[model samples]
Target: MRVEDAPEAWEVVSSTERFKGRVFDVVTDGVRMPGDEVADRDYVRHVGAVAVVALDADDRVLMIRQYRHPVRRLLWELPAGLRDVEGEPLAETAARELAEEAGHRAATWHTLVDLLTSPGMTDERIRVFLARDLTPIPEEENGFVPRHEEIGMPVEWVPLPDAVEHALMGMIHNAPAVAGILAAYAASVEGFTGLRPADAPEA
Candidate 1:
């Protein structure tokens, strides 16, 4: 289906800063009907951001355990975040998020894909990257709030195969993490045509 074909119009109604200091903007959008009638709709405009799947020399994936308030569940997933600030490019954002969320940095960066988290209602896009050539950097050096607020985050290295299995089995609930890990494996394996190494383009 063509996304542009969807009939919608948006106008900025107002914007406000929440208690957490996060800016929340309300948008008035119009939805077209079968008879060319339009119904105004309202939604929010959130700054987009990135996610990174960092791998170490042991072929183990770097992951963090954290709590998600929306689902009311703890999740095991790749390092990710929203643009803590506006006007940040996705590649740099991905690198920064990896360091902040996982307390790690990559010497090399490769963009795997750009994905739409929710295209129907929100303007959120997640650029997923594959990071290797890692060097452990301190969380303080990264200048990020640790993954958890009251408690500390446990960063674990899960073997890639096991991570993939867990993802398929629904144990790893982070969509970006699952997608990133599978894409990374495809790039490394000879038979995975859907993904090619970041250093090389698909044939």
Candidate 2:
């Protein structure tokens, strides 16, 4: 048998929106189980997100430190953003985030990995892209103004090997960043021959 993740939908007897927030919504669903028992499952409804592992020609990955309030700590994370725009391509979202947050754009892009991001608790999904051929965006041409935790965020270029080590050492706590860094490292071992196109279909 092939090893794969197959999709199946249990019958949802009823669903109710429990709360609506700026970034995501909480919902409760009454689902019918295999034994005919109905149970209420609470999960977050998310709009999804995209992240970029921007690798420069020197093999350094673009990184930024931002204060994540919920965790009450500053975290090193990849350039990322919510999928808030309607009908925008995922690659475009990734590019926009990279330029706005990291002040760079990529000439080459590939799908490095797809993540569920705590599927048991939230329906949040993220696409991590491997971006290369980076060119810094001139300050005058970039108009994005950082606010809140993003304000005064420090951007750094860390060697890919160092990044992988940091993640393994529990220094990089951001989920997508850890996954992307590891995935990028694995792909690079094969000269990135098996990476999917930037516009690959979402899992």
Candidate 3:
């Protein structure tokens, strides 16, 4: 039997907004099940996001540490941001995030992986990109100013193998970061021949 995730959606009998937040909204959906039962499902509605697995000339993956209030732990993560800009390309979002958060720009980019983060609880999807041939953006040219949780965020470079180990050892808890790290390593092994174009449509 062929194993693949095919797109399918059960009938939504009704949907109501439970709460609205700046970044995402909570909605309760009454969905019709196979047994003709209507089940109420509460899930978060998100605008999606993009992340970058930036690899430097020395094969080091750029990382950032920020305090996530809900988890209450300063976790290491890739440079990522929301797809909040209307009609903006996903790759552009990833590049913007890399420049703003990590102060670097990539000469080459490719789609690494796409994730349905917590599909059971949210429709938050993220696309991770593989970036290489990086050049630092001059301090004066970087116009983005960090604020709130972004302020004082520290950026670091870790070898790809070490990043994979950290992800497997449960040191890196960010879902996108873990997924990007493993996917990048796997692609690296094959000389990144399996990667798609940065502008490839999401699967």
**Which one is best on lDDT?**
3
Better candidate number, 1 or 2, judged by lDDT: 2
lDDT of 2 at 132: 97
* lDDT, ranked from best to worst: 3, 2, 1
For model 1, how does the per-residue alpha-carbon lDDT over 1-203 read when each residue is reduced to its tens digit?
Answer: 76543445444344443223263355665656566676765555777667888888877899888888879988887888777666656667777777777778788777776667666666666777888889989645766654344158778999989888999898897878888888878776853345434444211
In model 1, which runs have C-alpha deviations exceeding 4 angstroms? 1-26, 138-151, 190-203
Model 2: lDDT equals 0.96
Ranking by TM-score: 2, 3, 1
Report how far residue 76 has shifted in candidate 2, in Å. Answer: 0.4
Estimate TM-scores for all models: 0.76, 0.98, 0.98
Compared with the true structure, the alpha-carbon lDDT of candidate 1 equals 0.72
Worst 10 residues of 2 by lDDT: 3-12
* Model with the higher TM-score, candidate 1 or 2: 2
- Candidate 2 Cα deviation (angstroms), residue 81: 0.2
Task: Kindly report which residue pairs in candidate 1 clash with one another.
Answer: 29-41
lDDT of 2 by residue, 1-203 (tens): 99977788999999999999989999999999988999999999999999999999899999999999889999999999999999999999999999999999999999999999998989999999999999999999999999888899999999999999999999999999999999999999999999999999975
For residue 6, what is the lDDT in candidate 1? 44
